[model samples]
Target: MSWTSFYLIVAGLLAFTMLLVCWPWLRRRNSMVQDSLTNVQIVKQRLEELEREASEGVISEHDRRQASDELKLALVDETSLQKEGSRTGVLPLSVGAIAALLVGIIVYFNVNQLDKVARVQHAIDALPRLSEQLAAGKSEQFNTEDVRDLALAIRQRLRGSPEDARGWMFLGRLWMSLGQDVQAIEAIERALAIDPQSTATRISYAQALMVTGEAAKFQRAQEVLQGLLSENPENDNLALMMAVVSAQLGDADTTRQYYEQIKNKLPENNDMLTQLAGRLAELENQIQDVPQGSELDTTATPGFTIEVSIAEELKSKLPEQGFLIVFAQDANSDNRMPAAVVKMPLQNFPVKVTLTTDNAMLPSYSLAQLEQARLVARISTDADVAPSPGDLEGELNAKVVAGQTSSHTIIISKERK
Candidate 1:
């Protein structure tokens, strides 16, 4: 309701209450005035009777005069008392009404928190306009102060309505846009807690986590994306984010798998996909130099030795004229280019390949320098570096400690569509 209308209603109620309280006092005052008038009429009638009796000689003139004086004195006393009573009654009523009004005003202001209510109302009214402006890409129209005010308003509203998930989500996004990552994360987390099944909230949470650029947060983002993907496998946008996160964490096979899922859905020559393809190619080249069938000191070179196998149900689908590509990429770098890669003609089941610094695509940044790397194994129907329909792939993430070698297995169960 508008403040004007609310104020009008309150004022009317207060006036009606005051009237109800004073009505009885006013009625008593009027009754006292009527009684005083009646007493004066009775005294005048008695004086007339005494004069009539004296004229008829029923009593001496002196006695008659004495009775008349006494009657007049009694009448004077009664009139004075009645006037005093009227004054006393009115004085207290006036005082009480004034006191009641003052107390009512004080309580209304203090207890009602009218100022806070006004602020909240103003904010509620202004929000849609501001949001519309932002949605229309006119965020430049709003200054920093405007955003701060809006945020404060939302907070005040949330204090009264803590369960509003959409409010929390909007607040989180607003903070994110302002580069307040911690606040953004906190707000988004609240939204997720309130409504765990909200896809938008989960996506926002993952984005917030990824923006922190911390390994732990990235891992969390990966888990969130994985959950979302499980629920919505056909969402190309989610798949795209999953691919990016996987690449950032150096999970080459998962990255490639996600990338391929969205590749067909996106426009040809998309820049993001092109960049991903280049990174994968670099990773493939790095794995090409690892030696085979020789017992080597694993401690001297840190990398992964992977065992690749085909799923039983898909064995009949394997192409006779195909090549196997195995690659590893640095997990921590934003560049995401492969540190090592190996490619060979398709061989028998349970193919074994090793990747190390010796297979580095670039000597400047090799697997030996990596703290972690992602391994991918793919069997493609053709020798092209880019994956095609019917390619089988799998991936794993492994630590690359200089004094240790990691071993993992990849089951090429998923086929590219």
Candidate 2:
């Protein structure tokens, strides 16, 4: 249920519970007052009987007077007892009321679980907007804490809402952008399971599989894309992914076929078309360089490099298996989104890694376009691109110019609190 709905339900329940708890007290008070009034009327009726009997010579005047005095004493005793009963009840009722309030407060926070429920609900509510920011590559505006919260919130929501196909797909893409291939594959697989025929989910799943670096998985991605292309032969996205997969599989002819298909569909003089043309030329050059049976090395220059190390004292805190994230962001920007990022397995200290234009989270913003930037290297236990609690991190500042090589070393000296 949504947080707002949950809260409304809880509030209704609380109101009912409180009413129930106080009902006995309220009823007891009214009943006590009525009982006192009834007793007084009964005493008056007895006194009238005594006076009538004495007047009719049924009893002596002395007897009537004595009986009247006895009745008065009984009335005094009853009144005193009722007053004492009320006074005695005050402490217990007060204690019970206090106890009920405390229990309600505790249950609201625990059994009702308002804190986490409200947190995830808010996150789920904000997901569409957050996804827009991510697509626009406005991650620099987000902090590590926000990203971590979002990830956790998504996980929390997905647990109760497994049928949310679109949410799963978005999560899969988010993981892909964060370079968490395993998680990306898992989330996309869930999305595919929910909607097997969704073209978007299929494409995302295929891309995630390709990033796994396993020959078998890469082949699976190729098969998926190949099927997609059979259904929509002119699909540019499918063709492009097919080309990449083909090149990876050492199928030069198939790669050329897909690339040409994409090229034929694009308009001339478009920037994307020009970029594709340049990529095709590079592919051609590589194909010519390799022998008939040999594969071309597809490695390209990265945008920058970060040398990372951990302090000696913090080494013991590192886990055997985790992720190391190296990312760069514009120096003057207020946003925390990295212009480019790379994720690697946690390793020994003093590791060197590169960030490339290809690592740019958003197509519009890349490390190569920045004039000055700050690089952060973090060791995270959860494979999170963001620096969350318990993660070790460090940062270095550097001057950057598009197409110019940049390098810097950073030491992971402090743990995220």
Candidate 3:
């Protein structure tokens, strides 16, 4: 909700409350005024009657005079009493109204934490701009202070809107961006709890679990990915993540199984298949060692020498503390998980990196498995696990020949949207 709307609602409630508190006093004051008027009218009518009676010889002048004085005294006493009652009633009502207003102000400022609300609202208002700047690779536009303020705002908002799954997810992503994996996991778990049926939220939760790099967390991530894969068997992304999780858990058999499932679906001579085959072989070699003099076969490994550069016009947009990621994946597959990947701090343009079986993201997947692959070079300002908006990226399809290192040039010409 907007701050303006919140403030308006609060003001309206306070006005309604004050009216309720003062209603009885208002009614009583009006009744007293009416009664005073009625008494004056009755006294005037009686005096007129007395004058008529005296003139008609119904009473002597002396008796009439005495009656008139008594009547006037009674009227004076009644008027004075009514005035006293009015003053007495007004004092307490005024005091009560003032006290109630003061208490309301105090409660709004203290109990409700109006100052924190204002800060939260300010952070909320600044969100879009902050996101835009960050996405644009302008890290200098924000700082730790800005992030802290935003985190505090999200926490405060969640207190009042605990059931907002999207809000929780947003907070989780924010924490992830800040490299707070534990907090990110907690937040995404909350989102998943709120929306158990959301595939995206579940995927995010699993990713957070995997980021911790713990064996137990890897098992948990595997479970989550397996569950998702069961529900949507055709989802290559889930299958790929499952393989990675299994590899992380040291489950070589499961990793190879998932690898083969994905590998079989690709076209013949796919680049990822070559990488996967070499990685699978390596996994097997780990279980059974060869003779001391015998060396592991390197002929099955696929290699790529990548030359990465940026477009001339986009050079100025490069981030100061960015990373260059080069990876090879199956050319025709919808899955984006790379069979082999390399990450290095971005320093200069025309940077060269070599990808081999050792660079495989999973132990059972490597460049040796594919005949044709999509070579990608990306400049990630935030070091995100996946490509995101404002990140510069370039890709080209290349053929993979086992035992032969291919050279390719990738020009980072476009920003991811």
Better of 2 and 3 by TM-score: 2
Pairs that collide, model 1: 283-338, 284-341, 286-340, 286-341, 287-340, 287-341, 287-342, 288-341, 288-342
Worst 10 residues of 3 by lDDT: 289-298
List runs of model 2 lying over 4 Å from the truth.
1-11, 26-31, 110-171, 180-183, 190-200, 229-417
* Residue pairs in candidate 2 whose N, alpha carbon or C atoms collide under 3 angstroms: 139-337, 140-335, 140-336, 140-337, 141-335, 303-356
The residue-level lDDT of candidate 2 at 113 comes to: 56
Where's the lowest-lDDT run of ten residues in candidate 1?
A: 381-390
Q: Write the per-residue lDDT of candidate 3 for residues 355-416, one digit (tens) a residue.
A: 88788766645676566899989898754446555789989999988788888999999987
Per-residue lDDT for 247-314 in model 1, tens only?
65656788789988988887788888877777666555545644456754565778778999989988
User: TM-score order of candidates, best first?
Assistant: 2, 1, 3
lDDT of each: 0.79, 0.76, 0.79
Candidate 2, 376: how far from true, in Å?
A: 20
Model 3 residue runs over 4 Å out of place are: 1-5, 139-142, 148-171, 179-183, 186-207, 220-417
User: Residue 369 lDDT in model 1?
Assistant: 56
